[model samples]
Target chain A: MGVASTALPRGQTVPLALRWRRLGRRLGFLCGLAVLLSPALFVFLWMLSLSLKPDVENTAFPPVFIPTSPTLDNFREVFATSPFALYGRNSFVVATAATLLSLLVGVPAGYGIAKAKAHGLAFVVLVSRMTPGLSYLIPWFMLFRALGLHNTLWALIITHLVIGLPITIWVMMGFFEDLHPELEEAALVDGGGIWAAFRDVALPLARPGMVVAAILAFIFSWNNFVFAVVLAGPDTRTLPVAVFNVLTFEQLAWGKLAAAALVVTLPVLLLTVLVQRQIVAGMTTGGMKG
Target chain B: MGMTLTSAARHPGRPARRAVASYRRRDKYIRFALPALLVVAAVIVFPWLYTLYMSVQEWQVGSDRVFVGLDNYANLLRDARFHAAVGRTLVYTVLAVTLPVVLGTVAAVFFHRDFPWRGFFRGIFVLPMMATPVAIALVWTMMFHPQLGVLNYLLSLVGLPPSLWVYAPDTVIPALVLVETWQWTPLVMLIVLGGLAAMPTEPLESAVVDGASPWRVLRDITLPLTLPFIMVAVVLRAIDALKAFDTIFAITQGGPGTASETINIYLYLQAFSFFRIGHASAVVVVFFLLIVALAVGLLLVRQRTKWA
Candidate 1:
């Protein structure tokens, strides 16, 4: 199907059989891709529709795939009943702080690891990530309470860094490893110190990695729940925990839940799709595990 | 951004002055590393040490604790709930990882072609991953409703019976795996797609020239070349699935009689809900060990496979 210019003796007309076969293959390929992409896309579209519908239509039989009379009532309820704006603010602060913290610490760490070829040091970073959040849950919960930091954004930020910093370090290590040592070497020959070389040369070259790391770090922190649930007090509760809070009842408010979920996810989704190529790049570098 | 080159003896030119420069550079390296290491020590390492200590002692929140060495671990050995959660976590990880990888690889291979709107479609596919799991899970829980849900309505439109998803005890994990696959298959797809994009095309082109079928070309070339990426997908998905808390909590809360309770869920319940801090710490240590073992195994595979 990919062979657009197959060798077919210059003067010969195309064979009907081969054209039909190619057409069939193309159709089949399109069908396959559709089947693959449908579930996620359809579900997202469904959520969107659900979020827009009146509560009467939400649970109606012969369900509303699209809202006939679309309304903002659910979104209104989402904001009115809950302190969603406050939760959003908390999430923003926590995630941003986590990202900033990751950058502050992880960049230098990546530089050292790359320059020294310290695989073990990189592994140590990975180990922090590789351990499940639950492992950190109980102790952090207890210790933070002991230290009177339990309900504070500091605790949330610090715990969130456990998720973000490793990713930043991992992705940045790969970027630094891929750098040509000659750039730094040339800077050194120019009588510039190591700091000048790194700042003027290596760091500038690593801007893409920085963006990728920051975005990935922020996204992970934004989406995090366990740490927030275990450590965050009401004042510091982030969006995921807020969303989870709305589901505490056995009987769910699907409309409000859908609204809250959409509200919680919208920012990250837009940011991701807006900078998808970098997200793709970041994920692979961080995911493929340096 | 100051990089400290530590290997001074390996440098070119004068040895004497270079030694002083190298010493300064080493110091800078240590300084650069100090902040990150300190934070990790204070946050990750300290908590881990505390968890280890807590694991050995019989304790709970708001209670005077007794020092009961190895008792928590011993209790875990005899605990049926702990065993069930561990078993369920393994099953969940396996199912969650495998289905997504397989589906995602196929999607990736299909998308690697030069089709029109491929970028648009890929973006659509990647959207699910970008969305928060809490949102996805909440939406899915609604969709999984027995009645008054669009899914069952859609199934009825196709003349099929509506099925209980994440509701029935026997089918709970499979249903949760379905959501896992929906949300994460795109991530695996993106990873494999990256690998596929970077792959050399000569073998595939040659395969095509040899009158090979598309399946043959894929089997003989694309799949083999993408094995490392697939393994990456496996390792990542396995890791994420092993520790997943939000989606499971949102959708099922490890309910329908603990049928879908993974280790993370069980640990959360033990620690926070039950306030069995010592027992939960024991679970935590065991969970950490399992993660370490899994990670080491996957890293070995990556080593053996020689992925860049």
Candidate 2:
């Protein structure tokens, strides 16, 4: 209807054929979106159905798209037998630690890289990020083990840093580079020290960007599958690892598995919803550089 | 933030303390930047160097190592399984990249236009991208169950035949691709949506005003301008697809008889499962080179197109 309406702006004078064309165009556009989004949407709904269905219903042929007599057994099972609460606590601690550590170290580095125009350092950081996690797996595992850090939250926290720090640097790099230097210069002219100037002028302006970076980093650390699987201890399994343990220990219990999976995804999903705009910005801006 | 940057030297009183002040400032920059650099070095540098060293030695878990030169590389090249995996990896990456790019662009375009419940739909659209990948894998694993899965149930309603998806060797990569496409297409859409939002409106308006069909206006004006952003998406997806492991690991573990084993799976199997540490180091180095090469090539293309 967009171009069609442009061609025939006046509704009263528009020909019937033109009106039909506009309707057809609008229908076609809506259909494209429908076809594109249906699979993603359907899978989610199907997961919901799976989670709510009975164990017998979960395996029935012509699988129930919507549960007729949904039960809370799966949800009950998810919390009843497993150490889900412990896993959730562990994930929170590790993800928060990673985010705070990344911000502590990466923000200053980002500002330095921006001001110094340190392309080489930036390249080094980006390449570190680009390298597959597998490449770092064995060595980090052995090194931490050698240092008596294996199976400790410390080890997981350190490994998670590899994922979170680069993200902070990446998002903050964009923010710092775009920040006007004049603000910092004005503070310096007022006889402030460099740190004072940064704290007063630059840091406040970059707060929004820092929040975006932190949220992105937090989500990534929370969702990271490999690092936790390899580094975390028997007592310190993250949610992904704990959920995986459910899949294996509980066997194919699809209903319970669905419930477990949903539990694992809920926190991250809520965070994403809260900061959808920032997540999109962080991803696109960080993605563009790589 | 190791060795990030130095602070500026403070003005010395009567110019007598200039040297010490400047030195301290330089030291401060070194100090501020050092922590990040140290972490990178400890995490990436030390491990990578160890991997390179391990690649040349016949090392195993809890065993003495001996120098083996490039024999592991040579042996891997001669292995048919490795070659097949390389081929499969390329094929998977191609499908994974192409589908998301095209479908995502279309979805992006559709969302760009004024529509009913656009915000609500967009919120739904981005959910897939934000959900944990491990969770997505588990959910898809359930849905991919042949007789009991909801996907086939839906297909049965539409009169389409149900087929073995990840359970069959031949269809395993395709099934894996389906999961990947579902998970990643939203990301591509978000990127393209960002691009579309940023695009100038004048060219599109003028094209429609000049009596061009809507299709022509899209093809000639909209698509070309968004090509750069699309290319960026391509580059990101390509790298991601090349290294994809979690879903494959969780669902199939490169199974249905090695049908879906990408480089990552193979490396994991060699290193941790089989304990062929030396051989796995060789695989690591080779994979690292592949990533670097693709990244450089894509960056060059991006630069040539002025997408920077």
User: Distance (Å) between predicted and true CA of B209, model 2?
Assistant: 2.7
Candidate number of the best TM-score: 1
Collision count for each candidate, in order: 0, 12
lDDT (Cα, tens digit) per residue for candidate 2, span B1-308:
11111222232133445445534554455455678998988877999999998898888887898899999899888978888888888899899999999989988887787767766677678888778888889988888888777777878889999978999998899999998998899889888887888889899877766768778877988888888889889988988898898889888989988988888999889888988888999999988888778878987988897865
Local error of candidate 2 at A123, Å? 1.1
C-alpha lDDT score of every prediction, in listed order: 0.83, 0.82
- The sequence of per-residue lDDT tens digits that candidate 2 reaches over residues A125-211 is 878876888879888878888899998888888888998889998888899889866466556545677787667777888998899
Using DockQ as the measure, the top candidate is: 1
- Regions of model 1 farther than 4 Å from truth: A1-19, A250-252, B1-30, B298-308
Stretches > 4 Å off in candidate 2: A1-29, B1-31, B114-117, B301-308
What docking grade applies to model 1?
A: medium
Q: lDDT at A262 for candidate 1?
A: 90
